[model samples]
Target: MLFRVDVAAAEPLADQIAAQVRGGILRGDLAPGERLPAARELADVLDVNLHTVLRAYAKLRDEELIELRRGRGAVIRADADAARLRLVELARQFVGEARRQGLADAEMLAIVREAQP
Candidate 1:
């Protein structure tokens, strides 16, 4: 999966890296059991600190989306559910956009209800 980060963006570089990986998983570009690039290598390619890539991998590990093993590096979990993860990511984006639009919880709920068929 291709990773890109915007230094000028408000979000941290690590979060950006994590998000791209999540997107890759969700889109089936990264498959189960597939090993991700080494953090140090990715750091050099992305021109970010090794800690940044490590932090991103750590986040994915914490979320149970990837496994970090000694010498194995980071591997996409065999049981990772892309569909569920996609739904969760979508929900987060929806909520963030709604809040940016000055929407309240009730309004967001109502909008979702209206969207349901």
Candidate 2:
């Protein structure tokens, strides 16, 4: 899988890396049992610290989207569901936008209700 990061962006490098991996999974570009590039290798390519890549991998692990195995590196989980992951990604974006707009919980819920057919 290919990954990119913007050092100048407000988002942390690790978060950026994680997002890219997540996108790849959601797009079917990265399939189950596929091994990701080693953290050291990816860090060298991205010009970031090794720990940064590790942090990203850890985040993916926490989300159960990837599995980190000794001597095998990181691999996409066999049970990772693209559709469910996509919904989670969309919900996160929606909530972030709502927070930025200063909308209250009730207002957000109302909007979601209206959005439902």
TM-scores across all candidates?
A: 0.86, 0.91
- Pairing residues by index, what is the TM-score of model 2? 0.91
Clashing pairs counted in every model:
0, 0
Write candidate 2's Cα lDDT for 1-117 as tens digits: 678799999999999999999999999999999999999999998999999999999999999999999999999999989999999999989999999999999999999999998
Q: Which portions of model 1 show Cα errors greater than 4 Å? A: 103-117
lDDT of each: 0.96, 0.95
Indicate the worst ten consecutive residues by lDDT in candidate 1.
79-88
Residues 53-113, candidate 1: write the lDDT tens digits.
Answer: 9999999999999999999999999988999998889899999999999999999999999
